[model samples]
Target: MKAELEQLKIEAFQLLNRAQDSSAVDALEIDLLGRRGKLSTLLARIPELPVEERSGIGTLASSIRKELQDAIVAKRGQFSAPTSQSLDFDPTWPGHSPSIGHLHPVTAFLERSADFFASLGYTIADGPEVETATNNFDRLNIPANHPARDLWDTYYLNPARAGLLLRTHTSPVQVRYMDSHKPPVYIISPGRVYRHEATDASHDTNFTQLEGLAIDRDLHLTDLLGTLEAFLKHTFGKVKVQVRPSFFPFVEPGVELHMSCLLCGGKGCSACKQTGWLEMLGAGMVHPTVLKNMHVDPAKFSGFAFGIGVERMTMLLHGIPDVRLLLSGDQRFLEQFHY
Candidate 1:
């Protein structure tokens, strides 16, 4: 038994010295020192020997086990020792550059439209998103119970004190502007509006509107045409414009303005429904009743007003197929509009 113990001690030391890596060291430790190991098996036989022999063999076995454990630990540490003389890192490698951002397409378009009108001597006007029912409807000549009111179906706010609701259109700003300022009033109102309508590819319950009003003595439809023509040219880059007769409660002889189909170039296409023109906005001479309601004498002062859907124009100009994308916060869709 003593001879076997001596043989094991020599074998274990040789294996531990030859161990080249951490895994090899681990195997050596398990085989030499673990439970059920060769040394343990040999030691277990000691209890069966003569009672006088047990103490000597047991002491030798314990001494051999401790020596092998120390050697195994030393082997593991050797593998983990640092290979370098000092700590260091390469300084020449390039670093990451952060991304740059620009305005959203809708906001960019709004600013350009405002700047264009400002250049034409039209001061920008603004009004509250929550407004009295009178300025939103009646003052614009759309009185309650009037059939024309049916056309502007909107979300009426709850707790209807002061008949307040989210402004259905920016036209209310023009009414507010006219009430305070006298003619020759030249102003454009650009703002967000709310409607109680269902959303589809082209419509949203919440969207933006830009309305323009120009009031002065002897203003005619021709002046409206010329100003809009220059604006269309400036905006869409030399597109043809057409005005067809339509009706609105606020504008007598109201006209729906159309721009040449950018996709088909006025030759007829699905986008324009074979008409070669896309309806852009509604405009006309201000109704005399609206003028008189605002305290502008219709006999002396005449004007023109137009309301444009800013999102509709942005979608058209940018070839954005869905109106919801303007409001969608998806980074991939919005990244395409970044400058």
Candidate 2:
């Protein structure tokens, strides 16, 4: 029994040294130390051995198990050590360049328009695109059964709530500003507006509008026309302008301002539909009823208001044919305006 134990110890040591990896070492451990293994078998046979020899044999088996465990841990570290060469970066190589972004055409136009107004002593004002019916319609002198309400063609956020709608124009900002501030107000509201309508080459259901409002002791229709003329001349560089009578519910004695078609230089052309003129903006004296609604005394504080389509101005300025292209997000269409 002593000779058999010595032979098993030598064989186990040889197997442990031959193990090339942690997995092989684990298999060897199971073979020698498992419940049905050689070590376990020897331990199980202790009762068959003389009682004096059992203690010494058990001690030897435990010593062998400890040695095998230590060898496995040491071999695992050596097997996992990285053998590949380290990389060194070359400082002389050119680095990658990150892309730089520019403003979109619509955004560029808005900035330019804001700058133009700011130069005229008109501070920029803003309002919520999601607005109530009173601000969007009623406060602007648009009554429930009025035809002007149909013209707004608004996008309602919630119909059952009676008046929550996406604003049809930035004119609502004028009402809000009046409600909050006293007269001698000079503000240009520039923002996105929504409508429910079929899109065409010239029209978009969603577009931008810049509405200007100026209320003081003695504002008039002439002051409104003069301001628009100055803006158009500054914007288009010495362009010709003409105003024709028009109608709007919020403004009394409204007129549609027209500039000679930039594309054809006032000569008949396809851009102006052969009329030699392009309607640009709508301007008029602030209606008494509109002021009365906002608690402003129209008799003491008369004013003028105008609304211009930002997309139209951009198209006229850049000679863009389709309004849809402005909002389409097409890379090819946008790349042309890169500056």
Candidate 3:
């Protein structure tokens, strides 16, 4: 029994010395000191020996076990030295750069546009995306027969609430703003809007619209033209801007603003359908009925309002090929805009 104990002590020391790593040291410790280990097995046999012999063997076993445990711990420390040294990174080493994020192109445009308008004394205003027909349509002078009111053209929220729908444009904000405030209102509403329409490279069922409204005495089409031209020049950096007579329910003599296409340098392009002009936004003198509906005197005050599609502006600004990409949440597409 003493010979076997001596053999175990020699074997344990040899294994511990050869252990080059923590895993190897762990295996050696388990083999020597575990419940079913060599030491435990030999200890269990102590009762089989003569009473006087058991005491000598047991003492020897305990001493050898403690010596082996101490050797394993020391060996493990030696194995860990290289690992600890490897962790002492050079203080001057260049660290890995962290990943940075940026805003979506639409949001970036919205912020810049807000800043531009703010510089022009236009306060930002907000309203609910879910709105009533009175604010979304009727107050804007859009009637029941208007194409926009059709279920095919708009999203209705509740069948019970006949007029409840997701706002088709931020112009509803203009109505809501006028409802609660007196005239001399100068504000821009930039927000998400929805349409019940098909998706394509140029069109989206959901997009952003920025509506600008200013009401005071004697506002005219010329004033509308000048305000929009200043805004476009600031946004597009001195581009050619023009307003042509057009029609919108909310504007008495509506006009659509057009800018020369940057793609073909105003010569010609598919973007402008072989024409030099790109239809940008709609503006006009606010219709009398719209003011009357909001409890503002149509005779006492007049105004000009305009609506610009933020998605369309973003696409033109970045030369993005698809409107869907603006809201697709594609990190690859968005990472390109990081400044």
Candidate 4:
């Protein structure tokens, strides 16, 4: 019986050393140590022997099973494939370069635009995209019955609440700010605005607008023009701006501000509709009634306000032909803007 136990251990080690994979080692373990296996069969035979001889044979079988299990475990390790680092690695070797990501083009432009205004003593302010008709229109001199409200053609969130809706412009932030603050307020509100409009190369249903509002004892159209000029020059590097008479309910004597097409340098081009000029933003002195609606005495304080379309500015600066490209998730288009 002791000789049989020694032979079992030798057979288990030979099979374990020849194991090509973990599965072969597992099979060998069951053949050698499992119930009814060689070691277990020998242990079972011990019960039929005399008590003194039974103890010796049982001890030898247990020892043989233990040694076989250890050999199987060690052999399984030898069959495992080496890790990549263990097989081929140098401590001084240059590592694989990882690709880094950057901000979206619109976000990049928004931050730079805010920075330009922030440098000019304007504090950035924000308000909700979902707004009330009173703040968006009534407080902006565009009542429910007013024709100017048609110009916005907005998206209504609820039929109740005097027409709760996604704000058509960032001007509501100006109204919200004035409702809580007094005169000498300087704020620039940059936010997403919604309009119920058809998508085109030039227009999008959703876009960004940066609204500027500054109120003081005396603020004039000249101040508004000068501010717009400085902003345009700083943003576009010395571009010509043209302001023409326009109409907007929120501001009196509203004017449309334009810049020479950066693509054409004022020469006729398809992007500018062969006109060589791009309408950049709208600006004017705050209407007295709009101030009165905010409960700020219009007679004591006057201000200038302008709303600049951020996407339009991005298009002009980057020479992007389609406004849709700004909203498109095409990585090729977006990856061009690294900084």
Model 3 Cα lDDT, one tens digit per residue, 279-321: 8898888888888887889889999999998887887788776
The global C-alpha lDDT for each of the candidates, from Candidate 1 onward, is 0.86, 0.84, 0.84, 0.86
RMSD of each: 9.9, 10.0, 7.2, 6.6
Better of 2 and 4 by TM-score: 4
TM-scores of the candidates in the order shown = 0.70, 0.70, 0.71, 0.72
Q: Please estimate how well model 2 matches the true structure, expressed as its whole-model Cα lDDT.
A: 0.84
Q: What is the per-residue lDDT of model 2 for residues 1-339, given as tens digits with 9 covering 90 to 100? A: 667777877898888788888788778778887778887887788889888998898788788777767876676656675544312455687897986667888889888888988988999889999999888888888888998888879677765787798999998898888778998989999999999998876678999999999999988888998899888877789887888899999899999998888877778665577788888899899999998887889879998999988888888899887789998989888878866
Off by over 4 Å in 4: 1-95, 160-162, 267-270
Question: What does the lDDT come to for candidate 4?
Answer: 0.86
Per-residue lDDT of candidate 4, residues 200-306 (tens digit)? 76689999999999998889999999999889888888778788999988889899998888877788676677798888899899999988877778889998899
> How displaced is residue 222 in candidate 2, in Å?
1.7
Backbone clashes, candidate 1? 0
lDDT of 4 at 246: 94
Query: Clash number for every model?
Result: 0, 0, 0, 0
